[model samples]
Target: MAKLTIVASIKVKSDQVDFVKSQLENLVPITREEAGCVQYDLHQDNENPAHFLFFEIWESRELWQDHTNNDHIKAYQAATEGMVEEFVLHELTHIA
Candidate 1:
């Protein structure tokens, strides 16, 4: 199976940007250590402080699914609940 690519876009409420960003940053080290994680990078939009993006590459869809079930992920969900304005996720297969 080919590697999986995930693009996650998160838009936080303007007042919650700093708090949400801290929570998002806390996810990086743990996620990078997970199995099948090739790359896990986070970005914040320059012009829009409330916008954040995650570019992740996983070894397989199955492994990425496992990642979604992790404790830290659940904790993140709980911590950021109601703070986000919009959330979007895209899963892609690299083809070339």
Candidate 2:
């Protein structure tokens, strides 16, 4: 199976940045602990703190799917409900 690359951008409400960032940071260590997780990084935009990014790599699409269904992931979805103003997901493959 081919490895997977995910780039997700989350635009949170300007006033909710700290709470959103805390919630986002909670996902990192847990996701990193998952099997087949190559990398799961969180980044905040220097210019716009309300904009956050997730750069993830998984061993396969299946593993990435597993992550999406995980309980923590579910909780994240619940916790961030409405706090997120916009979200974009991109699934990718490395050429280099």
Candidate 3:
């Protein structure tokens, strides 16, 4: 099966950027430790401090689904629910 990829673009409130960044940083190690996670990285937009991106790669779609159900992920979602201005999630499959 092809690998699964997720691209999440988040726009945070200007006053909440630092706090949001910190929260996202905490998820990095936890995500990396998940069984089927290949990569889970957080990136900030060079020109826009309020914008951030999550680049995730998983062994399969099933694994990605599992990730969303994980306790830590659930907590993260709840914690950031109202802190973000906008959030977009995109799923992709390896092309080559």
Q: After superposition, how far is residue 20 of candidate 3 from its true place, in Å?
A: 0.7
**Clash pairs (backbone) in predicted model 3:** none
Question: Could you give me the TM-score of model 2 versus the true structure?
Answer: 0.96
Q: What's the ranking of the predictions by lDDT, best on top?
A: 1, 2, 3
Report model 3's TM-score to 2 decimal places.
0.94
Poorly placed runs, candidate 3 (over 4 Å)? none
Largest TM-score belongs to which candidate? 1
| Higher-ranked by TM-score: 1 or 2 | 1
- Model 2 scores a C-alpha lDDT of 0.95
TM-score of each: 0.98, 0.96, 0.94
Q: Compose the digit string of candidate 1's lDDT tens values, residues 5-48.
A: 99999999999999999999999999999999999999999999
Candidates 2 and 3 compared by lDDT, better number = 2
Model 2 spans > 4 angstroms off: none
* lDDT against true structure, model 1: 0.97
Per-residue lDDT tens digits for candidate 3, residues 6-74, read 999999999989988988898899989998999998999999999999999999989889888989888
Q: Candidate 1, 67: how far from true, in Å?
A: 0.5
